[model samples]
Target: MFSKTCEYAIRGVIFIAQKTADGSRIGIKEVAAGIDSPEHFIAKILQELSRKGIIQSQKGPTGGFYLDAQSRKHTLADIVHVIDGDQIFTGCGLGLKQCSETKPCPLHNEFKKIRDAISKLLRSTHLGEFSEQLEHKLVFLKR
Candidate 1:
């Protein structure tokens, strides 16, 4: 699973992508409300994302967050990398620091399979796909 910040960032980014796929801008309030995240938490996440160039933002009137065509092409893996690093894809499932192939934890082998599957899903899923799924009501970012 993703960290709380990672989860919110993914949700916020997808909402922005859905709203701004046509090169428009979406406010943080709208993104947070759309994904049911707290405004302050999402705002901080967005700020970090903007700082990292994972998403773009502007200040003042008629300014907010927007993802250009190239940005929309980035995968969920990219966002995960920016916010959470490669730990989720590389770390032990049971939080074992010394777990590895040779000195495997009890759940290491099985967890590795699941982890790889999740990694592939993230790597293959892009911002546009995130938007499209929401646009079609095939998935929900909120409860």
Candidate 2:
């Protein structure tokens, strides 16, 4: 499971990715409304992403958040790291600080394999590809 901040970050990223070519910048209020997330919280996540160069923002009448070309190269892992930090993925699922193969926790081996696979997938998957997959799923749902 992901944190609320992580969920917000993903929604914000997907929203930006969907509106990328609109030329009309999307404000935090609009993004929050569209994603059903808190405005302030989403704003904070956007700011973090912007500060980390994962997303871009402008301050003016037409100012808002948007993703630049470079943002396309970013993966879910990058967003998660920006919002939640890398420790979330690296830590043991059972909260064991010393979890390892030899010194395994109750579900260490199984959880570690799942966690490692997820981490790898997130690290290697780009936002563009993620958006495409999401779009496909949405289409399937509609059908």
Question: Mind giving the per-residue lDDT tens digits that candidate 2 earns over 5-87?
Answer: 89888877877776664455789988888788888988988998898899888999989888777787899899988777876
lDDT for each residue of candidate 1 in 32-129, tens digit (9 for 90 to 100): 88999999999999999889888899888989999987888889999999999999999998898999999999999999999999999999988887
Candidate 2: worst 10 consecutive residues by lDDT? Answer: 134-143
- Which lDDT value does model 1 have at 115? 94
- How good is model 2 by TM-score? 0.86
Colliding pairs, model 2: none
Highest TM-score: which candidate? 1
Runs with alpha carbons beyond 4 Å of true place in candidate 2: 130-143
lDDT of 1 at 42: 98
- Per-candidate TM equals 0.94, 0.86
